[model samples]
Target chain A: MNDRIYMDNCVTSAMAPEVLEAMKPYFGEEFWYPGSFVSTGEASSAAFEGFREVIADALNAAPQEITFTSGGTIANNIALKGLALAHSGEGRHIICSTVDYPDLLTHAAYFEKMGFEVTYLEPDELGFVSAQKLKDAIRDDTILFMSTMVNHVVGTIQPIGEYSQVLAAANHKIWFHVDAGQAFGKLHLDVKALGMDTLSVSAHKIHGPQGIGALYVKKGSRLGAYIHGIKRFEGVQPGGLSLAAMAGFAKAVEIVYKDLDGSIKQLRELSDYLLEQLESQIEYVELNGPRGEGRACHNINVSLDFIEGEAITIMLDMHKITVATGSACASQGLKPSYVLLAMGKNQVQAHGSMKFTLSRYNTKEQIDFTVAKLKEIAAILRERSPLYNAIKKKQEK
Target chain B: MQYSEKVLQHFMHPQNVGEMENPDATATEGSPACGDQVTMYLKVDKENLIIEDVSFLSYGCASNIATASIITEMAKGKSLEEAKKITWRDAMEALDGLPPVKAHCSVLAADTLQTAISNYEIAHGLKEVPDFSKETIIGELKKIIYPQVGEDIITLKMVKYVGFEEKTGEVLIDLNLMSFDQYRDNVAEEIREHLQKYPEVKDIKINFPS
Candidate 1:
């Protein structure tokens, strides 16, 4: 297959060369378990410490505050469920936005099933969950307030710090969890600045290997009460970590932070140019996330009426262009995105959703190719559709 | 995940997906609930008793679109009656296996073909046609009563299923209620009153669910 235009980077990015090189040594010559007490294994333990330091430095977290997990989903589950279970005696009420990733909500759902009262806050039209909305939704019994910074599907950055300030002022003693899977390498993150108790990140998302991720557990935060452990960084995770993937994670973060300015600038330019090009070819193609500030520079989800996103995606894949209809995790369900539904789009518009996420590897030429192919596919599908005819009829009348 | 080679083959090289300019029959199935609809066209040779061509246009997910394409290929050379008999299972098999959640897609494909055959019969003035009026009204009523569990209400023997007088709007319904719950009765009564608002419904009969 000719170099397929990879648009599903939000699902997983091509591993960065530097990160790959960093992982190679650990996979072969230095492949020793960090937990081993043997004299030669001391180097592995030191390498593990270096991995923790890199992640800690990136997030402005204490090295002791970071806990490695299998991936973002597990980190999210741990954050939500661990908090709910540990604090269930304190208060059983948890408030989270409906726009949060379903896997995150699934963890919260388990709590709901276990007899906790959950209030799923809905985001506003632009995928913004306002601080006032959080304030109003908070109950006296609410013990946790959770949200995702930069929703993975739409890539809209939430006002985490603003919302956290309100929770801080109320002195509500609520544990705050921020699922920063999409935001990890793409944007700045500081655990203290956000006032969040727990934050999640995945390795593959930042051009590292899959099955390795980390969580930021702010020191003295309420979340620590829930996820307690004596071994391996205080027991947030009980098992010995994958030292090899961790090696990749550390290198990936190092590269991102080192080239953060240039990478983010390229992502923004590609995203802006792609949107501009798409707007020229398609009618009523509304950008689904934040139109200006508060949007992640790497993602652009759009809803184009008269075209089913799945059809466009298949046709694009045929042209060797890879993209996604929605979040890959829930794409198979065929339901209009719950995130978009919570953001106030009706079923038809929500079903016709497509997400274009840029990585450091994406370029302007690739974006141009994608837009042209998408235009052709969308136009062809629309021409064959009777619903498109009805829509056109309504527009004309 | 990598799909089986059969899936990728059908997906990558879909057989038929366009309109028939002069179709022997046309069918359109509308899924108002999910709002994903499909219209299919077929060219059948009556003397030969085989489909000469098949095509479809779908406004749905990838699985739905792919099912339509696969159905068109599968029905291309079959007789009208044989084509109409294409089950959701057969369509799914042609594509190896669709994700189970999307098995309903194959049903949509079959329904679209049935609708096109019905259209062809109407246009050609087939003398003896199945009376679709009663089933159509009942299907519409079921759509309102049991939005999520439409299939369940269909199986229940509680309502007095009736075919109404076309012009007078009078229904000959027999209702059976096995349970005496007020909530259940209220739902039944609401459906009854809503149907009465239609000009063609004049009278109804009730037999308590036994």
Candidate 2:
């Protein structure tokens, strides 16, 4: 009971002890801003570049191409707005999918309000915004196309390679930006192979400290200054980012990338076991996203029928288990998950949807315990549910 | 926002929960599509016109279950007239308080209780089936809480006008909510769900202060 089982890694995760250890010195006696002439400044500058290199190596990007930002949202803002402002003179049309992360969708809205034309492509039932749709939506005036590499809600991994080819085949240059906040450590990302003009990745998603993320800008690509301030770290979005967090971010990246495939496999196996246990123990459960390799490794979303999600989440919370739900009742705005809705789920399904994002820290025993408790909780909630009773009565007849 | 300790108590272990067999009257309110629904059962003492027993089954969130549990507790042993007088606010007060967003759950619970009582009265020939009119629409609208404030839209003066066409069964409402209001969609959705339950309402059109 003392150990809480946390499965909401998609939101955030427990920072690794090693990352904290790496960050301790930067927070203490060795703290110094990057500068020149002085030995302290030179040492700090060298350390900063080394940290940048670690993040760059994870994405197969050059160190100079990566700019450390405050977080994923900041990186997204800098990339999307900067790309739009830099290339707006050529065209004002932007393309994004309905099921993209809010970072990209909100930017699309802002671009629309700024008098730019936005084409919002709809995702398929499994939350796949196909590359063919991107190709079709492309126009001569399309200046930028934004996408989420891995959907934050359903974990559907978009075809970045195909998207890159589609944009490349276009007659004109259409700056491509990707919100890879969910994809950074969970999947293999190569900026050169993917050919995206700009991409954003966050550190906290991979057991790093919060408040630090990086943006990759392809060489020869120009970005208009979005954050105008003193030149500190990277000139792209000039501001003072936490040097200690950067060190921790690099350590987190190093640990994950040390055996990226092994880490992904571990997550996939845990999530698979979780899904299998849930299905075996529970009745009338339905998986919400892609079933196998098509989905990201860490996420397993499902909708349990005859009960609402908030009640189930609360019951699980009582047992010291944390999970996420798409229920409108649990949301601040009282709206169901837009990603679930856009994936063609009904209100009932969306309300019943539960998302379990596993990490390397999760275990088979934890999954089993979670499923067992969830089974009992589901039974209790169902017994108290009018919806379940109505359906049972119908089935009886 | 967090639920009160009392709310968590009732939600975790709700009282008078589950279906009641041989109920004198039963009524269901809200809808599955709206992410919440409650069914209430009542057993009234015909001679004394007192509610002998009351129970509820909810297909909603924690607050929804808590509100239903509290509403039943409040209605038990009370006269049918007294039970009908019980409002959502009283239930919220009894539960200490609910979050502003979850305040609508209390409304659903209380509405179901009142409807069950109304059903009992009509079945026992104590009252006639109420006529459906603009006033009925207004009464239903009063049950729709503006989640931002946990108050009825009518009480907040958010409902600028309400109109109903008797011949066409069309309901039209003009809300003072701005286009940018975060709760605008929620309010509109609740209004439609509330009115659409009435057989007289054929169509609903809600206009915001765009």
Candidate 3:
């Protein structure tokens, strides 16, 4: 009936037209790889350096510190494994939270299998892992710690500054790595200010093209090579990366960093409006994450009582809207969202949770239409819900 | 895995979906904790032993709702004996096919319908309440789908052995699932939920291949 309304920007976003325009030339005649002497190669090398500078500038790091990777997952692998391999001789203990992103958790599992001990810090009910907990979990043999800057599921922004302070107080060096795939453009990140030894960010999360991301390894940190294939450019991740995609990533970074404050403000307003509308229009809706500034600007997660999230997601899809749900039925593994469960939410709450991640493209009108359609869907589904009927009967009694 | 066009049609616009007032017989299957629960209501023609009307209320995913809707449609005009023959496979065939992971929804819908029919027959003095025993435990196990293959564990031979200690109300099951099987946890959780409803099963221990 209408153009597809995409609200799942946290997974991937619509590439900006400007980024495509910037990438076109690289895909065409300027596609030469970086070289030592050839004119075309030198020019390509200079352009590559310039693109790296754009991303480094956003993070207040040098161009040489940035290593381009295929995506956030690869970047995470390189930084995390590199840190582990380089420092495992020093200590075989790692620390992370139970509610961290899957990338970090999987890496933790791998480390555990490699004869390293891992301590998972528990998060508060609102999904915040306190720095005090991190300090307490630290041991004499703890050598590394990894955290997700902005939680992908609930959008809880962890206390990175306090975490860095705690790690600094440790007697032994504890390398800190951050998975900032969801935080890159949404928040102002200064690698030096955050005191993270290594960090990862993806281009697609900020209106850039997919299949391109960057890893920031703070200067003076020795990371063992994770990917060893070729000597194409100097970086931990070896092999040739797409010049066109890097150009697009640079363009996307420039656009967002150009007015980062303004973009964040707009997203916050849109999400606030959406949450407000849902609360006012719907009955028995509960917010899953923290309210106000503690949560990310783009994410709004809420649980609708008496209705399963998969049904709601499909009904909204029929209305030409796209969103995410935490229901076990929607998952390939047939398990509820681990993030919500880790936050002490019951299975029903997790099953009914709906996630709406806004972007620069969303508007007030779109939010209005979505909330209205969602209200109708909730009412329709509730009419056919035994849970709701049972409640009504109980109240009648 | 995607739903068939028929399944989507039924899910988007399910038939006979509502709360039935003054139903002759009713049964609810599954649980809210499992993320799916279905309640079925039936009005039977006592003289003719035919199902005069049928309705259902579902709290679950699209497939769960669609299966319940189609099961009600299939049972509406059938005799009690005829309705008793309707299995989850019939519902799956009626809806073209369902994803393997969602095949359990059909089982839940069919199970609810059969239970409603049993309730009616018992109330009408046509049959006695079945005794809960080892056979009853095995019958419930037959309803637990493997999810990955869209087949029950009993049919797939995943159930290595089933033991019941009637005096202690303890049930033991040895499964052939490997320790690394992705569906290992799902199948075990399903078994517990299915058997926990029976008063005879006070405890369950599921053994997997280490």
Best by DockQ: 2
The order by descending DockQ is 2, 3, 1
Model 1, residue B167: distance off in Å is 16
Number of clashes found in candidate 1: 18
lDDT of 1 by residue, B1-210 (tens): 334456556544556776678888787765422546788888877787578988887776666677787888778887777887776567768777765445554566666777677777777776455553667557534423321222224455455666667776556555554563433553454356435534555665544556
- Candidate 2 accuracy as TM-score: 0.98
Cα lDDT of model 1 by residue, A271-309, tens digit: 888889988878769889787557888888898786677
Q: What does candidate 3's lDDT look like per residue over A92-123, in tens digits?
A: 99999999999999999999999999999999
Q: What is the lDDT of residue A34 in candidate 2?
A: 86
**Could you tell me which 10 consecutive residues in candidate 1 chain A have the lowest summed lDDT?**
A326-335
By the DockQ metric, which is better: model 2 or model 3?
2
- Correct interface contacts retained, every candidate: 0.46, 0.94, 0.89
Per-candidate Cα RMSD to the true structure, in Å, reads 6.7, 1.2, 1.2
The reply for model 2, stretches above 4 Å from the true place, is none
The sequence of per-residue lDDT tens digits that candidate 3 reaches over residues B1-210 is 788999989998999999888999999999999999999999999999999999999999999999999999999999999999999999999999999988987899999999999999999999999988888878988999988889999999999899999899999999999977888999999999999988888999999887
Best by lDDT: 3
Task: Please provide, for model 2 over A179-261, each residue's C-alpha lDDT reduced to its tens digit, 9 standing for 90 to 100.
Answer: 99899888899999999999999989999999988899999999898888888656235867778999999999999999999
Error of 2 at B102 (Å): 0.8
Instruction: Look at candidate 2 and give me any clashing residue pairs.
Output: none
